[model samples]
Target: MGGSLPRSVDDLPLLPDLVAPQAWSADLVAASDGLFERGVRVLRDGEGGLLVIGDAVMRALAQDPAVGGTPVEFLTGRAGDRVRRATGAAPPSGAAAFDAFLRNQVFTMNAALHVAVRRVVARHLVPRAVLGMAGHAERVLVGVLDEVTRVGGVVDLERDVAGPYVTRFWTDQLGVPAGAALRVQQLVHEMNRMFLFAPTLEDRARVLAATEEYLELVGRTVAMAWERGDNALLGHLARGLDGIDLPGAPPDLGALVAANFFDGFHTVAVAVANAARCLLADAPAAERVRRAPSLVAAAFTEGARLTAPLMLTTRMALGDVEHAGLRIPAGTPITMAWIAANRDPEAYDEPGGYRLDRPPRLGTTFGGGARICPGRGATRMLGEVALRALTATSVQVRLESPQPGWVPGSAIRRHPAIPVVVRRVAAA
Candidate 1:
């Protein structure tokens, strides 16, 4: 849901070449400040095109009379059809078109993974395991806290804690093959590298190769589950890949598995790292969250809002439409800067402040409308469990460095590596 791009906007290049992760952060802050005081500002992109970055513009686009329908349709199937008709090309099947659409844009695996993981998570075996693992993770993290006092130094949260938790959960609880889980971890690391720095052709090749292999691993696992006649697994798989029509109705299991790996492991890893960074930045907040495990959800939501594991969302205008007095012709690309929307002062109080007590509000983190993230519940569950584990453990964390930065891709926002020191607390 968060991944689709409108046909009109597909070819439009909205992001600058020097798109840094911090770039949007700055832009969002400026936009928020300006919007609060002066109303909406329609800035022009580098190519003499208009770009709307204010909350009112986003709200108007989302709710105005001219644009009131489904917010996501402009970037998905409907928009694709419009583009095909305009270009005089054969209309591709929805599933095939969606697949192709994702390949061209950034971090579309989120949508693919939503389909894939939900299949697995909805399975009796997997969901049970996930819930059980959540409990186990809480215990493990709490145990780690108990041992923190012995080390009495900073620890790398990702390597020492987050990575290990994921590795253990996927391998032991989820029943994924041990080797595959390890490879997934490696793939996650590689993705982090490629996303953060400019990689050479060889490096890109290596990452893609590993990605394919990991997908195959997941495919095998899903197949095994299906062989066991897991109804939930089968149903989830069928619905998630509903748009994809295979020969004799056999699912393109490989593609589905690949999508899962891309969406599941990678984004969660980034979210965990960013959450930890946020905790370190505000020690009091960390302590508060640790004491109240239920606040885990709030912390995760806030982290996602601030860091936005996925950054930019794109849509194409279905027809020539005038929005807020701006002429957005048919087949034009529209880049919805979710980062800007989440930080909009009008929607959020103290737009820049990280407050866990904020009301139950939906942010653009999982997106909005029909294309909203289906795996939202599971993602929140994962964050809650992981945070619970860390907080329960008697682990002491100290930020050893300055604010950990993010690597900005056209779609996903990730931190390269956040180095911190964690030590076990000795028994009293």
Candidate 2:
């Protein structure tokens, strides 16, 4: 491996078949029920990773006053040689590997550069993203529905309406070039599978090549946006605020763009679709949101709690850690099951139910601690705005197929297509 990015052989292993039944199931998280119900708080996976579950461990891992702030390093291994070998750079077994690792690390999650890049980029993205969802939200969503109605009003909900809406916001508000959002999303996702999840070396080689192509494409896009100097997120990073480069040079143009679009595309899109799925599943619930517009955010939050868009995250123990009776050795790879943790019965009255009245900031849908998702506010806003706009119309929202299911990607839970039929309601 040239760079050290793959999490584990298991995380994003090449699928045995193209599509798994679990991916198409009504309940996406159902596959993990047994793991979630294990009597022990921590279970060892075959790959030597630790699986943390239930209310107690989740609390300790996420929010224990004493251990809550413990540093869990991001997953990266000695793939420096791999990157060097793959990219054909002169390298021996010394600093070459480390340097290669850092180079590859820059564009990925849990990078040394992540903090600085996020600090710079969020300052620009957050405000505009909120504004896009606020000011142009109605217009943006109207556009989505119009597209939905155009194709006979029958869609897989996820691929058609929910998926496109995220890119539309990026293009319309974030200054991403028109018609480039889809391609950008495609490239970013290929990278994201490597960045956020684990893939085999063979798979990594294939995707990493595409990810490099993505980086190149985004780099060019960022250059144009930088020259334009628009107030969009891209411009802000290009403007170079927050002393981003200093101490260490700032991330390259493509990494910055990858930071924005890669995660933004599917995470928020799946979340929006999840909200729509939850809303459509219950007429009364959708009606409640329609009646009390303010609760739209709650609907999105609830949907995320049930169907986490990015279900699990890797956290490496900084040192030997003990919480209650469980002892986690230092340097152990701990997989935080946000989905299982969110659904832990101890945390919620009815963990699996789609009720929108839960306490605010209830779960790790957007992560927690130092690594809390910078775009949570924006994600919620996007979902709320999109859902609000859709429900505003008197259209029937239902499952597209007789048996609806989620698409298979353990790293990112999505529906290959959640078919839906939207017909106008008859006037009284």
Candidate 3:
């Protein structure tokens, strides 16, 4: 939000690269502090360079059209050019290559195009009847939790509850086959590597191979939608709604289907896990949620605020732009620091600590302004349902292991398998 991206590491003090894949949450917290303490809103971090932080700077990114026009057109998307120069292997194609032209298609289309597609996507996510939809998710989640507790309350919460719970919701609403949720989750993880810090040739090649299989699965589900014929997510999208025109609907509906699946699954699952982990840590909040089910939505937002599922986003400069008084030239690489902005002290009280009473409206956890995530409503609903169900279980959620064995990825902080034990209340 602060300024145009620094062209090179030399543009500013060689601040520790906050965007590096190996970099942990601690690194980001320290880096955010240094940037604000030193009064530099932008710096190139290790692995992934040229990060913009601070609330004022993020505001600049939102208001200025140049910073966000098309994500891949900017310096960040030139990994292929770098690959050709280094390895002599041809760059990837299709979704694997993270094609420059498609970047513009991803977000920065004309206002009309954004409106047309967004309407369709938003309908499923932010339904007119919130209580009705949330009730369905809650019912499904209760069934899932009952099954898990029946077998034994000891299970990997990340995989068993967070994922399968949401997966069942999609299946019920979209009318897809049962047990395909884990497969979708695996494919989305591979596909998301493209957005991480300069994915290696191996990563690109792997995604290229998976893209074929991934699209095949999306097609299978689309066919499944034909069988179900319900007004769920896949059904509604496959036939193409009346108002959405040709351009609004993707020529390749499978690809669009895959994209929509990607949008909600990982982010929502991670948010669910994070909230559970937070509530476990703060038992008081967990107990409060148990007493008042309505507080689940606020807890979900807080969980995302603490640990953003998608931490960093890359944007390119369309032309020379001044941010926080620094001139970033055309074609410079700029990384948007969603994680750092979420923790900005100016924006929230006790930004570091877990505060259930903290305002839910702060930070870019789901993004800000026009760039706000469309899946936000769905994410919150899924999380609320899952957490709400947990409160009713009359059990204590404790970490299976002392350590949070977080999975390493390009940009995403994933909760792959969280071993947790839920002690049931027999007296109840």
Candidate 4:
């Protein structure tokens, strides 16, 4: 279909209109497959930008310096801002701070800024540091599991277990006072909605409100840590930010906190839910994990490969690049369909199978290349802890329905309700 770049983006094949809405509510994987069957490795997305499918192209795009992390709007356009203004969703108070927070986030930065922020975040989130938190993560998960089993009935895994477990883990990890954990979780949850694929004015308004409060909360938390000399992750972050230089002036402490904590929580929570769902569905795998708890890590990795937490991520082209016999011009926005890439037949054998023996990072779930997710280590560590504790528990989970119910239109893949019946197994 491609000889040279299309004369215009409109000249390319268009993605189905329903892909975005259905992506979160239904099967994003199916939509990805449909694109492949039509031989649409690269297509024009009606919403905006060029949509890229297939493993090779997606990986090449992700790794290319010309294809970057900043959203196209920030790079070249502001359509969403125009729409928000037209809808009378005036800029919220602290809009400057909000914008700064987004710009400072590892996801939105590019070039020098991206490198600087990633370096700082990496120091704190390295695999060794994340692994050190394993004991605490295990305790949090075990407590949550015990509470869930004590209730003893049908449970929504996402709502009842994964959500609270993550909330508690992050709250503890961040050195949040026990009393404030719930509020911190609420603020992070609200802030996370801003990551949705396309938010209405109402959604933006809600996000603005939550982000404002969340920033204030971070300020107070940092202040308290300084006052008390709290020796937790938040304190480490606070100490770490001292005198750090960036492209612009250094980002506010709150921006750094939000960048590290909120982003990690979103993907990790989804990974936990997806991993748990996969384990519950695969009896032989679950049994093997149960027999050798060490296999829990592999099980978590396989689960993430099957259903990535983030279905897709968009990048703006810094310069023209050629891929698949097509010339993508500079400033063109490109959407990398990670869900499709993870399951690409060319990338994995029996892509649908729950095989733990596969090589590491075979999937695009956490993305790849220069912008591979910085929180990937932490995500896996947390997922492994949750799964290990689940296997060790005297509890059993079976799907109440054969299929899961997913949250609608979210940029992040999430299960709103994985209804499961729980039975406590008598200990041997």
Q: Please give each candidate's TM-score.
A: 0.68, 0.77, 0.82, 0.88
In order of listing, the candidates' clash counts read 25, 12, 6, 0
- Residue by residue across 1-428, what tens digits does model 2's lDDT show? 11121343333222212224444133435644543443333455434556655655665665532222223123334233334444455323233322322343323333445556556656655755576557675576677777677667577677677777786776666566867877866664565444323234554555556556666665677667767777455555566643555444434655555545556766787788877887877788889988888888888888888888887766666566666545666666666767777877656777778887787756878766555677777787888887787677566676756446654444676656677886556656
**Candidate 3, TM-score vs. the true structure?**
0.82
Please list the residue runs of candidate 2 whose C-alpha ends up more than 4 Å from where it truly belongs after superposition: 1-28, 35-38, 63-115, 125-133, 188-206, 240-242, 245-250, 423-428
Q: Give model 1's TM-score versus the native structure.
A: 0.68
Task: Return whichever of 1 and 4 wins on lDDT.
Answer: 4
User: lDDT, candidate 4, residue 153?
Assistant: 85
Q: Which lDDT tens digits does candidate 4 get at residues 11-77? A: 6776765355455236667777766565556777765678876887788888888898765346323
Number of clashes found in candidate 2:
12
- What does each candidate score in C-alpha RMSD? 8.4, 7.9, 4.2, 3.3
Off by over 4 Å in 1: 1-52, 56-133, 136-154, 167-175, 192-203, 228-250, 319-322, 325-327, 408-411
lDDT of each: 0.53, 0.60, 0.64, 0.72
In candidate 2, residue 184 scores what lDDT? 65
Roughly what TM-score does model 4 have, to 2 decimal places?
0.88
Deviation from native of the Cα of residue 89 in model 2, angstroms: 23
Residues 1-428 of candidate 1: C-alpha lDDT, one tens digit per residue:
01122334223334343233345443444433554454443443443333445555654554322321223333344334433544555433323423432342222322434334444434433445456546655664554444544555565666556665555454333345556766767866665433322234444445455555555666576566555655344445546556543222224544444454455566665667676677558767788988887888888888778766755555444467665345666555455566667777667798778888989986877655434554555566667776655565455566777856644322456555666666555667
- Which whole-number lDDT from 0 to 100 does residue 294 have in model 4? 89
Ranking of candidates on lDDT, top first: 4, 3, 2, 1
Clashing pairs for predicted structure model 4, backbone only: none
* lDDT measured at residue 230 in model 2 versus the true structure, 0 to 100: 71
Best by TM-score: 4
Cα lDDT, model 4, residue 64: 84
